[model samples]
Target: MAARPEPMTPTGGRLAIIAGGGRLPHHVAEAAREAGEDPFIIPLTGEADGDWTGFDHEPLFVGDFAGVTRAFRARGVDRVVLSGGVRRRPDWRGIRPTIPFLFRMPRVVSTLLKGGDDTVLKMVIDLIESAGARVVGVQDILPSLLAETGPIGAVSPDDAALADIRAASEAATALGRLDIGQGAIAVGGRVVALEGPEGTDAMLARVAGLKAEGRISARRRGVLVKLCKPQQDVRADLPSVGPATIENAHAAGLAGVVVEAGRALVLDRRAVIGTADRLGLFLAGIERETMA
Candidate 1:
């Protein structure tokens, strides 16, 4: 396991959210507001799908490192929280960096062209820090979003589901160690699907397709497991689940869903639990230490 960076204090200076598509960013913004801090949102153009009405924000392209730096300086932003889903990586040849970023462009290009998601995120964090802003995870701003150990709702995993969880959890951890992805699915104690660059929803869709085609056994349902990568910088890119996840899991014909306890985020907790319970599926937060 990798040592996580010490959490940065949320106090002092203006806070900014480098937003992407999904409800997580909105949740962070709302939490910041509830804490009496007005968050400035920098929604990535073409990537941020949520409505930003009434929130102070500016839109920027994903490759516009220079623009992001300028925004940070202009807004006096010293604390940044990265949230939501970024489906696209910038086109290397099209990146237009300036000033300090101009000097770092070579290294940035190398990492973007050669690195995995985790490496890319680390590079982004370094850039944010270089601009004098400390990067924090969504969990830091709203600890309530962190998934706790045990069942999340009315249902608990059966023995068969537990076995699938164990198999999938190990597979997820292994996949993360390689910086491949954070999710996997197992059926009857056998790994059946792995999340890739395309992400969790798409992966679940693939499982659904397999089940529909009669590839996966209709009688033996599976389980989806998500965990933080062994060497991940938990300050960013932690595995997350939400109502959509439960819906997809049900659609995928899975028996349950499991995530690393205290190390994953559950977006819209009530909705997630309600969806799981309503759909007759289990949602569990399992500690990695107990997986063995």
Candidate 2:
């Protein structure tokens, strides 16, 4: 990890976490609270950790786009961090919209119908910014989370692992195009586990269990794919992994990590790499088409 810039004096006061889903949001909120800045949490309803007792302040839950904005506004939070995302698509069935959401239908539908993740996320960013709130990516708040440059394992790929890494990277992008998920674990050219709403850790646990049961090999020949959705809204739900992933792979007795070269975030890169290196795990930032 690069030397963290001395945290710019908390930009006045509290840190607002526009948390969606996954462990990263919880991690970020806890960090913000420990920094002496009260964290204003806005959980994405079914998508976030609504029981956020770790944070210094209360949390508000919003199930829709309109509600999300208003709840953040209510907190009087001008600075915010976009951490993680809810994995499931909204169940719009039987759901009624608020008047404002109804009024903004044209703009919202126009973007959703005509755009990909990037377009939609950019629109959300604009919406939040217009509310006198500055929406920032997790990087803006935690530079220490990004991975550093270099191979992270004690034993670099001895050819076989490299081959699996290449294959998994390609496969991940193919899966991503369908918005299936951002990660998968494979063994000897076969897909062993695909990440679901349970996220990476659960997937890792399952694969490890399979290995223990003699269903797969526990060696460098294993494959891991961390990728971005083909139609990603980079400003929002881009794929990210950190030291916990490395720790997971190690516990699972896996071989390597293959993340989308430019589009993925290797959160806590230095520590992740160091841990991977210590475990003899191979790490590769691979190109999609090339792997495909």
Per-residue error at 282 for model 1, in Å? Answer: 0.6
Number of clashing pairs per prediction, in order: 0, 9
Q: Give me the overall lDDT of model 2.
A: 0.66
Question: How do the residues 1-292 of candidate 2 rate in per-residue lDDT, one tens digit apiece?
Answer: 2233434347664567777766778767766666676778777666675577755444444325556556556666778777776564333342244565566667766775565454566666776676578876665555445443335445566567666666666667677676656887767767778876577889998988988888887653577788777776654665676777877887788777767655566765667778778777777665565666
The residue ranges of model 1 lying beyond 4 angstroms of the native Cα positions read: 1-10
Give one digit per residue, the lDDT tens place, for model 1 in 190-240: 999999998999999999999899988878999999999999998888899
**Each model's lDDT:** 0.89, 0.66
Model 1 residue 139 distance off true place after TM-score fit, in angstroms: 0.7
Backbone clash pairs in model 1 (N, Cα, C under 3 Å; residues 3+ apart or in different chains), count? 0
Report residue 53 deviation for candidate 2 (angstroms): 8.4
- Which residue pairs in model 2 clash with each other? 117-233, 118-233, 145-267, 145-268, 146-269, 147-269, 152-277, 153-277, 154-277
Evaluated with lDDT, which candidate comes out highest?
Answer: 1
Q: What is the lDDT of candidate 1?
A: 0.89
